[model samples]
Target: MIADFDVSSDWHVAAPYGFLRGLRHEQPVFHSPHLGAYVLTRHEDVRAAYGDAKRFSSAGSLTISRSLTQATRDRLGEHGSFLSSFVANVDPPDHTRLRRSVSRAFTPRAVAAMEERFRRLNEDVLDRVEPDGRADFVPGLGHIPSTKLTARFIGVPESDEEFVKSHVKDWFMLFLSPQPADRQLELADSFLEYLAYVDRLVAARAAAPQDDFTSLMTSLIGSELTHREVVELISTILLGGNDTVPNQLGNSVYRLLRENIWPVPADLTQNAVEECMRIDGASLGSFRYAITDIDLHGVTIPAGALCLLSTDSAAHDETVFDDPETFRIDRPNADAHMTLGYGIHFCVGAALARLQLRTALDVLGERLPGLRLAPGQPIAYRKSIVGRGLPALLVEWD
Candidate 1:
């Protein structure tokens, strides 16, 4: 069955565990013809690969699918070269400075400061949902808070928040999804427009200082980072922060409810969120290019080969967690999951995201302890090699 594994197939995105388990068991590191890249599924291999960023470079690695066609490439190229400048894709010295500059604005102190705001935002959103006894879980539960908090996180003004919410950069991930060519062909032009809009925001922030993240970044620009770097960093935060966390809200609640484990004990629920993320976490990991022909676990990855590190599968590796496949609310060591990523490239907004998830779920459970999946409603997950997300989730509370 491992021989037949196909990354491009619909089944792989929706349900890959059966074959991913086979890869970790039979071949920890093997190149699959279907994926057109070398894959590492075992926990040890995935963690090591992430830690060895010196050997495994992150350039030109925005997605794990590696499916950009000549047409998509040309369309994307017209925008600008800033995509490669993303903090996640840059190597060592450059990565160090970029991350430092971004962190300057997103300090742990700053993240902690947002907790009260998030708690209120959580209350505000849920306050509306409570009266209905039913609500759209994905947006009502996750997207709204993610979008609002990120707007606050990035320092965008109230007038522009709607635009920020509208262009969540889901299109960027859609490029990797299994959509029709025409629909796929449609993303780049709009992306270029969104890029222009962000460019304007960067300019405005630079001109008139504000208390938000963008103005803070302006202070660091030139002295610590390039103007282009600011654009990339903000773009990454705006889009990435918006896309992943919202979907995770739906996925986490969905999993917990399906297992009949909602209203998780307050003591261990945060760990339950950690466990939720480990199992098929945001996007199925990402790509790293081998700097030179190298060997790992007896498998030789050629020079210039793209290695898709299966962080999702790694979570399930029997060696890491006692039972990765199960939803365990009381797991002692659940934070070990690599859902938000690892090493220097770990998500800058992780603390803020965690506060959002914990606050949202805790609020929902306390307010609507009997939330249930709506009858006759089918669950939906957006099809993508990266970005494991749901568009909507319907739930009712008696």
Candidate 2:
């Protein structure tokens, strides 16, 4: 079965566990002809790669240079250079300063201050769904608070939420998702428009300071970061913060309901969330480029080789978590999941994510304890390589 694995196949992208497990067991570090990169499947190897940023550069982690065809590159023109500036893709020294500057907004103290706001936003959204006995959780419950909170956090006007959301996915696809060069060119057009919009937003925030994230970046423009850097960081946040949380929302809730574990105990809400992250996290894994010819597990990855660290597969590695496939809310090492990443690259917005997710579960369970997956509706995940997300989750509460 391992010999039959195909990374680019629609079946694998939509549901990768079978293939990933095969890779981890049969070949922990296996090269995929389709991906033109090595795949690290074991927990130990994947975690080590994330920590060894020096050896594995983050640049080209999302969008490999070879993926950009000549036509696509020509279309991107000067704006093409900004792709490397995304906070997640930059290496070491540059990443350090950028992360520090933005860290103020996501500190535990700052995130704690946001709990009350998060709770209210979650409540407002759930309140609408309570009247109906059944609903699709994706747009109705999952995306509502996430979009609203992220917009408000970043100083994007609520009126423009739909506009921002519309373009964020296309931007994600342009970099993370594999598509034909012609399609990438089309995506680049929308990406440039969105980039320009963020540039305007950054300028506006600089001109009239506000009590939000954009203004905070603007305040540090000349000293710690450049105007263009601020724009890139904001664009990164918008892209990063937008999809993952919404996907996590659907994934967490979907697991609980499917496993018949609803009405999670108040004391175990955090544990429940962590277990979800371990087993059914939103993101599959991130990409990195090996800086030197390296050997691991009887395989040698050439210098400059691309590696897809399978954090999802790592989470399910039997060596890391005993009986890893089972969904256990009380799992002791659940929080160790690599879904949000590891080491210096760990997600900065983790605090915000936790606050929102915990609030989502608490509010939904308290108000709709009877929640259950609607009968006769099949659950379908998005056809995304990096993100494991449900497009819609039908549920009902009596």
Candidate 3:
């Protein structure tokens, strides 16, 4: 069974549940040549690996796909090794310290305070499309609000929005995918440019602080972090919210309408969002490196082995979720899905993401209860192993 499963095939990358379901039952810890990692499909195994930081280190989790060529390294110059201080790619001690420095921005009070503004943003975007009675929800409804709010939160100037938008995907591709040396070099140039822009923003904030995320980090530069660390930290936060929210919004809205669960009651909007996350989440899974030999179900993952913890597969495990294939907005255990993450490295922006999802649902449900997918439009998804998302969702309402 393991011999037949090709993790990189277009079929599997576009929709992998069928193959993953078989892997969960036959070989839960099968190693994949494409990913060069032992894939864990069971919910229990993935969750345990996530919580055990000592056994499964997070270092190099994102960039382990391939090594950089010396030419690419030279192109990067000082920016060649930027992930050293990224919160998601480091273990505790450094991870704890770095996470603590930005923890205040995500506190409940702070996140709650953004709801009023978040709602207005969603309403404004939806209002523009309501008169059309049809629109590509991905960009028209999803991307606009998410990008605007994230940029403002991170202190990106309106004048630089196009620059940031055009290049952030390069950062995503460079770190998240395995590419050829030449492609890597191209991405390296884009990344270095982005780093320089961030460095400029940091220096400006240091000289004249503002009420934004960059200013917050600049204040702690000498006290809690170094200049380079602050630059990498802000870059991580900027990229963190960049596509994840739009991807999730696209996923959630697609599920709600396709499954006829729209107009989710005001009280159950959160439950509906969790159900969408469980059934069709944007985050497929993430990588973790093994620190020591560990045996699971008669398979041994050797020391320093890379592991792909399949949260998407775990969310569909029959043992954990009854009638796993069914999309039920009222499923009692929908919140148990590991889409956001688990344990210490759980998503720091979970609250803000939820706020955006809930607000979108409320605004759409109130205004477009008749919403439905536009007929004759083939459903398509971006071919990404880590983040599952629809690039465009053509929607219509009476």
How do the predictions measure up, each by TM-score? 0.93, 0.95, 0.95
User: lDDT of all predictions, in order shown?
Assistant: 0.77, 0.85, 0.85
For residues 285-346, what per-residue lDDT tens digits would candidate 3 score against the true structure?
88999999999999999999999999999999999999998998889999999999998889
What TM-score number comes out for model 2? Answer: 0.95
lDDT of 1 by residue, 97-183 (tens): 888888877677888888788878888888887889888887776777777788887887768877766654645654444545555
Model 3 compared with the native: what TM-score?
0.95
Model 2, residue pairs in steric clash: none
lDDT of 2 by residue, 112-227 (tens): 88888878988898777789898899988888888888888899998888888888878777776667978888888988889888988988987899999999999998899888
If the candidates were sorted by their TM-score against the true structure, best first, what order would they fall in? 3, 2, 1
Point out the higher-scoring one by lDDT: 2 or 3. Answer: 3
Sliding window of 10 residues with minimal summed lDDT for model 3: 1-10
Worst 10 residues of 1 by lDDT: 170-179
